[model samples]
Target: MGVIDWAIVAIYGVVVIAIGIIASRRQTDTDEYFRGSRQIPWWALGFSIIATSFSAASLLGGPGEGYTNGFLYLQLQLGDLLGYGLVIALLLPFFVRLNLTTAYEYLEKRFDAKTRSLGSLCFLLFVIARLGGLLYAASLVVATVTDLPMGAAILLVGVVSIAYTVVGGITAVVWTDVLQFAMIFVGIGAGIWTAVNGVPGGFGELWQVAAANDKLALFNFSWEPSSVRSLPTALFAYGILAFAVAGTNQQSVQRYVSCADEKSARKAILLGWFSGLVGVGATLLLGVLLFGFYSINGGLPADIAADGILSHFIVNAVPPGASGFLVAAIFAAAMSSIDSALHSLSTCITVDFYDRYVQARTNEKQSLRIAQILIVVWGIVGIGSAFYAASTGKDLLEFLVTYTTMFLGPLLGIFLMGVLFPRVNSSGAFYGTIAAVMLVIVGSNMGWLTFPGIWRSAITAPLGMLLGYGISLFGQIPPQRALQGLTLWHSSKQAQALGRPGLEEEVPDRGDY
Candidate 1:
């Protein structure tokens, strides 16, 4: 790396620290720390959501997927689109009306404390798993370019992320995410430009080479669910996963709730989903370009792994200044995602467990301090888990998908039961969750399900809902009074009775927003 590249990375780090300091001055209470006082603009939250959902895993692993597997991976976006729509129509309004601090709070209000704890537990597990994979992905670029040990790179990324997230909280996270996304977009553009230019002909040659080798291929209409990129797996399995990630996961839910109002929140949700589509498309195109570049340039070395392809190109092929900028962008992408998850996981722990069960009467000042401490704790845990992730030797992007599918389906199922079937009591939600997870574990291990790991959510989510609903039939239906403002059927009425405006009540759009 040249002097300019190192300077750019250093400048980016300074700016990140400055943002944290600025945001820290504004956070005096838990509400401000966790929800940004419900005053952040929609577009900013939208960008944060996109950054969190896409992360370093997508930024790096996407091109890797493109290089190794062609366009088959793009089909996952189709399922994710449907999932976003479901979140906006069915889940967004309810979450906004209730004005929750965490998504799992709905579980407590709708069922019992135990169910809420279970949901929180599931989210914590998902975050740790996801955080590890993300850290590993980010470290690949750093290690490739700077010759840093993988563990040291992970530590550097983890410590930096924790510093900003702990001080700035959600407010800092959202605004910094806007900057990080810009860097990531530029980095993608540069990668594409260099990859295409590396070939004899630019776009024309890329098209010819990629098409000749089937790198431009988009669809795999195979019937086998075990095929990772098949249309059915992408459409059905990924569809369910998209909903769980966008609608049910705490990371996404926190972004929606932090918006100034339901209108802004809905708009932000749409912006996030659509922006993600564009981002995913760009990364995949960069992959195809890489394929063409490598094909004509004597091909990739046998020693490099798929996940390391983009890093290899950035280090060896790109101009010095731009290469450094791209490396910094990878860090930007990692920080953007890592900060969001850290803040959200900390918020989940504080609100769902600590505040609710341990110290209900603690003042806001004490609570905020506790929350900051948790961010550091989780940051350390994340760094440690990344070593395990690196050892697994799976493709980073698919590993992310597999991690999400493991617990998210049943968690989403519990939410569905809470909102759609008031008859499903707390016991049903609890047992149903357990049964679904066990089924997913056995199916994944025994291979009796005859489907790929991505299909875990699609197959099990429905089973969880059915099983939970059936169990509810044998239990007492929750009192209608208790169900008010918590379930779809009663949300409107309870919202009015509680003097909080229902989502149906539209607010005039202010130009300032």
Candidate 2:
């Protein structure tokens, strides 16, 4: 790489450090550290949410998917759209009204501590386990563009992410996301522009070639759930996953809690819907452009793995200094994601486990200290796990997504049961979760169930919820009267029972929000 490229990367690093220090100054207590003192802007939180939701997978693997599978991958994105609607219509009001610190806290008040711990356990595994895989994927770009070994690259990334997240907490993660989000767009936009123009044709010519090759094809409305990329199956899978991750996962939940009010929280989510649409579009479209680029030249680049197509193009195609920023964009995507996960992991542990079980009486100062320590510990776990990931040699993205979604269906299902179906007691929720997981494991292996691969989450999540719903219907047992505020229809009554503001404040008359 040229000196200018090196300079650009250095500058990016320096600016990130400056951002951490500035944001760090704003945190005076654990509440501000974890929830941004309810001062974060909705648009900013929306941007951060998008940044945290999709990662290097969307930036790199998306194009790779486009290059290899045509537009079949785009169908999965449709399900994610439904998640935002779920958040605005249902989840936003409840979370705001309760003024919860962690999403899992809702579970405890709704059912029991065991259920709350269960939900938190699922969230921790989903997020923490993905970190090592993310580190490995990001290191590919770092190792390609610099002299660092993959291990060292992973360490460097882990260390840098920890530094900012540990010091600035959620505020740093959000604002840096604004910067990283911008980088993602700029990098993807530049790549698309160059790839399209560099090809023998522009949009018209590229579309002709893409159409002929079916690279632009979308929505094969097949009913077979095992159809890996079918519209019906894939859409179903993504919708369930979006609700599980965006609505229930701590990573996304904490962002919602940081809003100044229920209105801002809802507005932020709406903004995220728009930003998410554009961000995903840019990545997917870049994939289409890359397909056209490679096709015009006859085939994939020589001396490159399929996953390295985007990196290969950046190295050989883009200008000098700009390439550094593009690489920075990849790192930006990676850093944004892992830092958010780390912070969320810490929040989940601190609020759900540490605070509740370990030392409920711990003051804010001690809680803040404990949270920072967990950040370091989880960061180490992620870094250490990268060593094992390198040896396993799995497709990092696929590996991460597979495991993350394994329990997602059951987890989201239980929440749905608690919120929407009041008759569903702890036993019903517990048994249904166990049955859903068992069904997924057996079906995935035996091929008895139509849902397979990533599609497992889609079918499995709703199946679990349905199981919970049906099983609870058979019972004459009702939820404890103390559990009223937690259910959707009776949130106000529950509030009255508990002497808190009833469901009225739980959901404001947010006409448009």
Candidate 3:
């Protein structure tokens, strides 16, 4: 990269840190740090959610999948779209109505302390691994451009992300996302433009190349069970992943519950849905274009990995200043994901564990201090984990992602059981999640599950839901008055059957900010 490009990257980093410091000024307590004081406009929260979703996974992995297998991967976006609708229509009401700080707190209200603790632990594991993957991916981009060791690149990315998140909390995370999202668009746009103009005959020639190679194919209507990447199966799996990530994950739920109103939250979530579709389309289009570019020029080099194609092209083909912008976009994607996870992890610790158990009764100021301390602690731990992955020289990201999926099916299932199935008891949810997890481990490793390949991924969540609900029926505790407004059906009938208004109305308006 040229000096001007390097300067842009450096200045961009400095601007993000400054945003963090400026944001820190408004936060007087844990509520602001953890909740964004519930004052951030819905549009900003929505944009932040989009930015977080546009992580290195989409920037690199999306294109890699497109390059490898054609546009069939885009089918997953259909399920993702449906998942967002489900979240806004079905999931957001309970989360927002509960006035949650960390989304897991709703589990405690609906279930038991043990269940809440379990949920929090799942969130921590999920986000920490996700953070590592983003860092690793960003490191790959740096290694491609600067010839730096992957470990060193990972450390540099991690430190820049953690620096701001530890100070400004969600405030910094959201505001910085606004800038990062712009950089992402510019970078992705640059790739698309180059792919088109670099080819001699433009869209006509690109189409001819893609058509000849069958790279434009987008489906597998065949009824094969083990074809995990098939359109139907992939769509279903992506839906499950989105449901878990958007509906049940702390990072997303924190944003939903932090909105000014349900209307704002819903709109913001819809914006996320829109962003997902648009962003995936852009990257996939790039993949198609690159297919044409390489076809006419000659095939990819023997040593160039599939993942490295985009990075390699940017470094070697694109102009230096432009390459730097693209690199900054990669960095921006990493920061978007890491900062949010740091804030979410810190909230879980402070609200779920520290405040709930250790302090039990800390004031707002005390809570704020603990939140900051946990933020720094978790940030350090996340960076250390990234360094560990780099040092081990293992393809550890995939293992962690696959391992996390074992929990996703159960985690999403438990949340559904709580919100949708009123009969599912705390004991049932706890045991059912445990059962699904154990079975998933055995089934995934042994490759003996009746459900084929990634079809198993989609099926596991419903299996978990059924297991939890069925077990609760056997235990059969009597219905109680307190169950009102916490579950979907219960909340509706509270006024008619119990002669009491909904409990959500009791969620305090803490506008003290």
Highest TM-score scorer: 1
The local distance difference test score of each candidate is 0.85, 0.78, 0.77
* Number of backbone-clashing residue pairs for each candidate, in the order shown: 0, 5, 0
- lDDT order, best first, reads 1, 2, 3
Residues 308-352 of candidate 3: C-alpha lDDT, one tens digit per residue = 878878887887677778888888887898888888888998899
Q: Global CA lDDT of candidate 1, please?
A: 0.85
Q: After superposing candidate 3, which stretches have Cα over 4 Å from the reference?
A: 224-228, 387-401, 445-447, 450-457, 476-479, 492-501, 505-513
Q: Per-residue CA lDDT of candidate 2, range 32-67, in tens?
A: 999988888889998998899768756778777777
Q: How close is each model in CA RMSD to the real structure?
A: 5.0, 4.6, 3.7
- Evaluated at residue 385, the lDDT of candidate 2 is 73
> What are the models' TM-scores?
0.94, 0.91, 0.92
Deviation from native of the Cα of residue 266 in model 1, angstroms:
1.4
Q: Which residue runs does candidate 1 get wrong by more than 4 Å?
A: 443-450, 494-513
TM-score of candidate 2 versus the correct structure, residues matched by position: 0.91
Tell me the spans in candidate 2 whose CA falls farther than 4 Å from its real position. 200-204, 442-450, 466-480, 493-513
